[model samples]
Target chain A: MARLSYLKALQRALIDEMSRDESVFVLGEDIRVGVNNVTTGLLAKFGPQRVLDTPLSEQGFTSFATGAALAGMRPVIEFQIPSLLFLVFEQIANQAHKFSLMTGGQARVPVTYFVPGSGSKTGWAGQHSDHPYGLFAHVGVKTVVPATPADAYGLFVSAIREDDPVVIFAPAGSLGVRDDVDLETLSAVPLGVGTIHRPGSDVTVVAVGHHVQTALAVADQLEGEISVEVWDPRSLYPFDWSGLAESVNRTGRLVVIDDSNRHCGIAGEILATAAEQMRLTAPPRRVTRPSGAVLPFALALDLACQPDAEQLVTAVREVAKD
Target chain B: MEASLYRMVRLIRRFEERCVELVRSGDIIGGIHPYIGQEAIAAGVCAALRFDDIITSTHRGHGHVLAKGADPIRMLAELCGKVTGLNRGRGGSMHAADFSKGIFGANGIVGAGGAIATGAAWAFLRQGGGDKVAVSFFGDGAVSQGVLLEAMNLAALWKVPVLFVCENNGYATTLTVSESVAGTICGRASAFGIPSSTVDGMDAAVVFEAASAAVESARRGEGPAFLECLTYRFDAHHTWEHKARVRYRPAEEEVSGRLRDPVEIAGGRLDPAERESIDEAIEALLDEAVAFATTSPAPDPSTALDYLYGSAVLP
Candidate 1:
C-alpha cells in the first residue's frame, strides 16, 4: 500500500479528471510550474493548452472560467494565495455562482475554484492569510474544505464533475496529511456529506477543514475521560446538517470547532442549527476566532487567532459536565 | 444590407421609446438603461457576424440584444419579470440573455463580460474552428477596467477570436470620458499589440465596415481586435434620472450630438418608401412586443428560490 499525501491526492484527482474528460482543464497563476506543488507535473502531462498560465488578474481569469464553463468546458482554477479569493469574490459569488440561477438554469458554470494553502502559514501575514470559505458558503457557492488526503482527492474530483460551480479550499496545514490506502480504491466523495472520524456517546464535536484532525487528536487524548465524536462536514455550503443531527441526537450535547470568525462563522451556525432542529441537553458551545479577527504578523499572535485544540478540549469538558 | 441595418436601428429606436413609456407607466419595476443613442453600433456589429458568433452586452444592452435576434416579445417579457422571459425573469433588464441566440448576457457589471467573451473565444479556438468569434460590447468607461484589459492580454496571447467593441458614447453615466478615462481607448488596445480602430459610431455604414474588417481578421485567427465607436447617448443613462434631475451632459452637446442620428443615417441609405416601410414595420413589431409583454404573467413568488443551484438537490 502506498501512502498518498493530501497535495498529491489533489494532483491525482485533477490528472484523472483531465484524462477522463477532454473538456476539463486547469488555469491559474504559475500553474505551468505548479506553484506550491499542487499543480506540479500538470503542465508537462496535460501540455500548455490544457494547463494555462494566466496573468496576475484574478477577476479576469475567474470570469474567463465562467465564460468557458458557459461554452461547454469545465475549468478548474487554482489560487495559490487564499486572499486572492477576496479580490475575486464578486467574480465567484456574484458571477459564476449566480450564473445558473440568474439564467434560469440555462447556464451551468462547472468551474472549480481550487485554493491550496488556505489559512495562516506562519509569516504569510495579513494580506496572504485568510479562510474566506465561510463567505462563499454564506452566499451559497458549493464550498468544500477537505480535511484529509482521501477526502481532498474525492471532493476535488466530485467538484469538477458537478454541473454547478464549486470552491475547494485545501488548508495549508492538512496538505501534508497522508493516508495509507490502495490507489484503486480512492473514489469520488459526494458533496453535502459528513464523515465521523471517531464515534462517541458523550458529545458531538463538529469540525471543519483541517480542524477535523485536531478534533480526532483531542478525541484520542480524552479517550477514558470523555467519548467525543469528531464530525467533519466535508462540504460546508451544502452542509451535512442531517448527518450532524443524527450525531447530536445520539450525544445530546454539541461543541463546534472552526477557524472562521466568531460572528457568522460555521461554528456559530452549527450551534444555532443544532439548537433549532436537533435534540441538545445543554447550551451548545462554539470555539472560533474572535469577531473581525485579523491574523497579526507575529507567529505567536497568528497562532492565537486560529482555534486550537486546547480551547476545543476545554469547550468539550465544559459541555460534558451537563 | 442597408435596409436590414435601417430596420434594426429603427426597431431598436421604437423598442426603446416603448420601454421608456413602460417605465413611466410603472409596468416595468426597475427603470431601464435605454440604448437609445447607440443603435447603430449594435446594428452594424451584429450584422457583420454569423448567427453562431457570441456577444456580451452592458447594462444599456437592449439594442445589442434586439440586433442579435432575441425575440422582442420575450425580451420585453423579461423586463416585465415574467415566466416566459428569456431568463424566466430571474435576470432582469441588466442581465437579459438568450444563450440560443449567442447573446451571453447584458451584464450589470461594467467590464466583467469582456473576459467571458475571451474565454468563449479561447474555447472555440481550442476546439479548432475558425467560424466563431466572440464579441464583448462595453463602454468608454470600461476601457480602463482591469479585467477587460487582462482579457485582451489573454486573447492576444492565445490568438483567440475576440472582438472588443467599445461604444465610447461620451459619458459613462454622468462622468465623461474626458473626466474619467485618461488615455485614448484605441491607444490602450495598441499597447497590447491588438489591431484597433476608431469609427463614427452614429453611422451604421462606418461601424459595419470597421466591424466587418475586425471580424474578418479574428476569423482568420489573427487574435483579438478592438473598435472604439465615438457615439452619443440620446437619452438619460437611466429612466430614474428623469425624476432625480441629474444634469450631466450639456444641452448644447445633446443638440449637436443629435445632429448625426443613427436612425437618420441608416434610414437615409434607403429610398423614402423603404424608410417609411421600415418605420411602419418597426412600429407594428414594437406594438406587438408591448402587448405581449404587458399581458405576460409574472412568475410565482413561491418559486423565487428555484434554480439557485444546478445540483440534483438544493441545499
Candidate 2:
C-alpha cells in the first residue's frame, strides 16, 4: 500500500473529479499558483478554464460561483483564510444556500467552498484562525470536516457531488497527517454517518475533525484503566444523530471535544441533544475554547486557549469515574 | 409590439395591486415590495431578451418575474403560501423564481444578484450556444455595493455576456438615490470599461431600445453592458409603509411621479380600441389568476421544510 498524506488525498480527489466531470471547476485567489498546496497542480492538469483564478473580492467570486452553478456548472471555490467565510457569509447563507428553497426547488447551487487550512496555524492569530464549520452547520449548509486522509479524499468527492452548496473545512492540524492507504480503494463516504475510530465501553468521547486522531491516541494511552470510544461525526450538519444515539446508548456516557468557541457552538448543540433525547449515565462534558476565544499572536497564549490533548485526557477520565 | 408591452405593464400593475390587497386581508403573510411605477423597465428589458436568456432580480422583483413569463396564478399562490405556488410556496414573495423561464430569483440582499449574473454569463460564454446573455436588475442604491462593482470588473475583464440593468427608482426604502449613492451610477460601470447609458424607464420604447443595443453587444461576445434606467416608485417601498405612514420625501414627489406613468406611455402607443381590448383581456386573466390562487390550499405545517433541500435527507 502506498502512503498518502491528508493534503495529497485532497489534491488527488480534485484531480480525479475534474477528470471525471468537466463541469467541475475551481475559483479562488492565487489558486493558479496553488498557494496552500490543495490546488497544487490543478491549473496545469486542467488548464485555466477549469481552474479559475479569482480576484481578491470574496463577495464577488462567492456569488459568482453560485451564478455559474445555476447555469449548469459545478463550481468549487477555495477560500485562502477561514475568516474569509465571514466576509462572504451572505453569499453562501443568503444567496447560494437559499436558492433551492427560494426558487421552490427550481434552482440547485452545487458549489463547494473549501477552506485549505482552517483554525489556528502555529503563530497566525485572530482573523486568520477560525474553524467555523459550526457556523455553516448551524445555518443548514452541508458541512464536512474529514478526520483522516481517506476520509478527506472520500468526503471531498461526496461534497462535490452533492446537489446543494457544501462547505469542506481542511483543518490546519490534519493537512500534514499521513496514512498507509490504497488509492484504488478510495470512495465516497456517506454523509450524516458517524465513524467510531476505536471501540470501548467506559466512555464515548465524540470528537470532530482533527480531534478524532487525538481522541484515538489518548484512548490508547489510557487503555490500562479507562476504555474510551472515539467517535467522529464526519458530516456535522445533518449530524448522524441516530448513530450518536446508538453510541451513547451503549456507553451510557458522553464527552464532546470540539475546537469551536464554548458558547453556542457544536459542542453545546451535541450536549443539549444528548441531554434532551439520548441515553446518558452521567452529565456529558464538553472540552472547547474559552467563550468568544480569539487566538493570540504569541504561541503560548494561542495554545492556552485551544483545547489540547491534556484537557481531553482529563475530561475523559472524569466522565469515566462518574 | 405596443399592445403586448402595454398588456404586460397592465398585468404587473394589477398583480401588484392585488398583492397589496392580499396583504391587507392577511392572505399574504408578509407585505410585499411593490413594483408599481417601474413596470416599463421589466417589460422593455424582457421584450429584448430571448426565452433562454437568464435574469437575476432584486427584492422588488415581481414585475421582472411576471414580464419574463411566469404564470401569475402560481406566482400569486406562492405569495399566499399555497402548495400550488410557483416555488411550491417555499420562496414566498421576495425569493420567487422559475428557472425554466430563466428567472434566477428575487434576492433579499441588495446588489448580490449582479455577481451571480456575471458568473452565469461566464457559463454562457463558455457554452457558446449562439448568443445566450444574462441580465441583473438592481436599484441605484446597489451602485455603491462592493460586490456589484467587483462583478462589473470581472465581467469586463473576461468579456462575459451580461447586461447590468440598474433600475434607478429614486429611493431604496426611504433614502433617495442621491443621498445613498455617490457620483453617477453610469460612472461606476464605465470605470470598468463597460459601455453604459441612462434611459427613461417611464417610457417602455426608450428602455427597449437601450436594452436591445446592450443585449446585442453582449451576445456578440463584447463583454458586459450597463443601463441606468431612470424611474420612480409611486407607492410605498413595502406594503407595511401604508400603515407606518413614514414620510421621508416631499408630497409632490409622489404627485409628479405618476405624471409619466409607464402604463399610460405604452398604452398611448397603441390604437385606442386595441388598448381597450388588451386592458379588458388583462383584467379577465388577472381575475382568473386571483381566483386560482385564493382557492388553492395552504401548505401543511408538518411539511414546512419539505423543499429546504432539493434532495431528501435530514436538514
Model 1, B1-315: lDDT tens digits are 999999999899998999999999998988999888899999999999899999999999999999999999899999988899999999989989999999999999999999999999888888775579999999999987998998888888888899999999988888988898887899999988999999999989899999999999999888899999999999899999989999978889989998989999888889999789778877887888889888988999999988888776435
Candidate 2: which pairs clash? none
- Candidate 2 on A1-322: residue-level lDDT in tens? 9899999999988988989998899989999999999898887788988888887989999999999999999899999999999999999998899888777678889999999899889798998989998999999999999989999999999889888999999999899899999878999987788898898998999998888888988899999899899999999987999988888999999999998899989999999999998989998999999989988989999998888889999998888888
Model 1 pairs whose backbones collide: none
Q: How many clashes show up per model?
A: 0, 0
Best by DockQ: 2
Q: How high a TM-score does candidate 2 get? A: 0.98
User: Given the true complex, what DockQ would model 1 score?
Assistant: 0.77
Q: Quote the positional error of residue B227 for candidate 2 in Å.
A: 0.1
Q: What is candidate 1's lDDT per residue for A29-136, written digit by digit as tens?
A: 999888779888988888989999988889989999988988889999999899999989989988898878777878888999999999988788888888888999
Candidates in order, interface RMSD in Å: 1.1, 1.2
Give the DockQ (2 decimals) of all models: 0.77, 0.78
Task: Give each candidate's fraction of reference contacts reproduced.
Answer: 0.73, 0.80
